[model samples]
Target: MTALPRNVPSSTDPHHLPGVRWLRSSYSTGANNCVETTRPAAGPWAGLLAVRDSKDPAGPALLFSPESWSGFTAAFH
Candidate 1:
């Protein structure tokens, strides 16, 4: 298996996946605390989850493989 790439660009990388729209959680509305997310347009990470802080759109993003994102969501639910 190939090693994952590091030092990805802040906005153009998974941190800001090109063409992948960002969305804020419905739970947020005029609140200081909110989470935003996006996903790849194609490839293995096509549907993988990319998360970041709403307060900092240009900040580093947390990439989670599809399965990992699902498990995280399930565990919290």
Candidate 2:
């Protein structure tokens, strides 16, 4: 697996990321099959972005650097 960024939180339970405001893209469809993202406002995870499947709020979250996430999303734009 690819290595995650320093200070990034990796958890099997989304609840591990407390105080995060998970939000789906405005372009998401009503089907609710989109992913959600949140940048931790405080704690050790602050500054890193957390992402999880909207359909599975209690599932694992993948962490990424803001730059990394920008690069990934830029590919589709």
Candidate 3:
């Protein structure tokens, strides 16, 4: 059986994602306390939107499907 590599990082944590680009809302101040969003381009997490706390980059991230994320924001909009 194939085994996962020790050096390979997992998706639960944003810091583990390689070269991921996180986006922050422009309305948020420069305090870096807001959450960040990024779309993972590959891996098992690919096609899912990843959200994480900017304050704690090493913290766990929340994954949401495209439809779910849209509905979530629509409520606020």
Candidate 4:
């Protein structure tokens, strides 16, 4: 299993995270069923990747390290 990122912040609320611009996958269509990801450039959550459901922007997101995320997603391949 992959390791979690260091300094994981307590706030998982997507809106509360500062200066984040969520991005959707290029493979995503307008259906809004896929997930959105953002890399916080500043604040406590910076240096970690944040992901949230496309259907709920106001909902909480899960944070992951770049390596950890890759390990998690690699299972699909």
Whose lDDT is greatest here? 4
Candidates 2 and 4 compared by TM-score, better number: 4
Task: Compose the digit string of candidate 4's lDDT tens values, residues 1-77.
Answer: 46654433334554457867788977789899888888888876677788887888776678888888888889889
Tens-digit per-residue lDDT, 1-77, candidate 2? 13454433434344467677788978789687888888887676778788887777776778887888888788889
Reference-based lDDT, residue 65, model 4:
81
Per-residue lDDT of 7-77 in model 3, one digit per residue for the tens? 22334554466568888867669898798888778767677777877777666777777777887778898
Error (Å) of candidate 3 at residue 40 is 0.4
What lDDT would each prediction earn against the true structure?
A: 0.67, 0.72, 0.67, 0.74
Candidate 3's displacement at residue 9, Å, is 8.6
lDDT of 1 by residue, 38-66 (tens): 77786444666778878887777777776
**Local error of candidate 3 at 70, Å?**
0.2
TM-score of each: 0.71, 0.76, 0.74, 0.78
Which 10-residue window of candidate 2 scores lowest in summed lDDT?
A: 1-10
- Name the Cα RMSD for model 1: 4.6
Looking at model 4, the pairs that clash are none
lDDT of 1 at 31: 76
lDDT of 1: 0.67
For this target, which candidate reaches the highest TM-score against the unseen true structure? Answer: 4
